[model samples]
Target: MEREIVVIATSNTHKLDEIKEILSDFQFDIKSMSEVGLGGLEIIEDGSTFEENAMIKAKTVMNKTGYASIADDSGLEVDAINKAPGIYSARFAGENATDAQNNEKLLNLIANVPEDLRTGRFICAIAMVFPNGESIITRGTCEGSIGFEPTGNGGFGYDPLFIVPEYNKTFGEIPAEIKNKISHRANALNELKSSLKVYLERI
Candidate 1:
């Protein structure tokens, strides 16, 4: 029989949707933070790096539920901005800033920056916390540049303005299937899957 698995520490429905889609082939049933009734744990993500944040979220959730949990911290790092908004990507504009506000602020910051200086990449760090309190960590990245303006309304966050150089298309311009295959989140999740496969094999 397959071991039961539950993803802890995130109420963001979009994150849950993507993770579920990515790991759809697994034998385990995946659930979101809300689905596990973890709406009470207000995880304070004050870490300076993605790994620290991921671990914090995962550990917090694991401590509460005693279930296998996964958490990730992802952000866009801009070359010209000195890798700024690195850990602060979500709250770049302020704690209460909306997606539009954050995007607008990012655009303005790079408004005068030419195409060559607009290089950036999305970084993701995933942390998995086992029921025994053991943990596994992995990371992945997708390089791209900031577009002149937001385009294609397919995704949330900074997806509309992020252009993948190899594909020459904004993330929001790609279909979910295609995006899920090549996104930063997908890359990180791949590492998680590899670890899962190893764990499963050992059992």
Candidate 2:
């Protein structure tokens, strides 16, 4: 049997890796947008919500490639700051902000806030768009708080400062093997996988 192809509409290497790892057991062959010749494709993410942004990317990719595609919009939301840097997590520092810069900015933003009040969460919304205009969306969130200083160094983006309450460790401190099972992306992908199973069976 030939393996089905599913293009993940993302250029962020970290996100691509996480999605691939979470869906490793699936029968479909997953390819990053760059791998599938959509590297230069730019889709504007002006959606007010994660789901809308995810849909924009997925639909754009599916229309351009004529293949089923999955896209996710994820970010860190801090309750202390009224959920700032939500959709703009990537450009939190600036348009060309580096991961380190973004992390530092986050740390400084909540530096004065008390540890007990530093509540936050990571949210991920995944959208799958098929060629026939059918689509499915799933969302997941990892509730936690922000650390005053960045810790460890494994995951990307704001991982170093985003604390996982259950483990009492920042995502950067958590190993990939363990992070893959509990991260926001993992949760969203798990939901996506369930829908993919039904979609695969139908087709």
Q: What is the C-alpha lDDT of each candidate?
A: 0.87, 0.90
lDDT of 1 by residue, 1-203 (tens): 87587774678877888888777778667878777787766889988899999999998888888888899999999998899789999988999888888899999999999998899999999998888756789898999999989999898889999999878999989898888888888999999989878876776
The regions of model 1 sitting more than 4 angstroms off are: 1-3
TM-score of 1: 0.93
Residue-by-residue lDDT tens digits, candidate 2, 25-71: 88778888888887898899999999999999999998888888999
The global Cα lDDT (0 to 1) of model 1 is: 0.87
For all the candidates, what are their Cα RMSDs to the real structure? Answer: 1.6, 1.5
**How displaced is residue 184 in candidate 2, in Å?**
0.4
Collision count of model 1: 0
Off by over 4 Å in 2: none
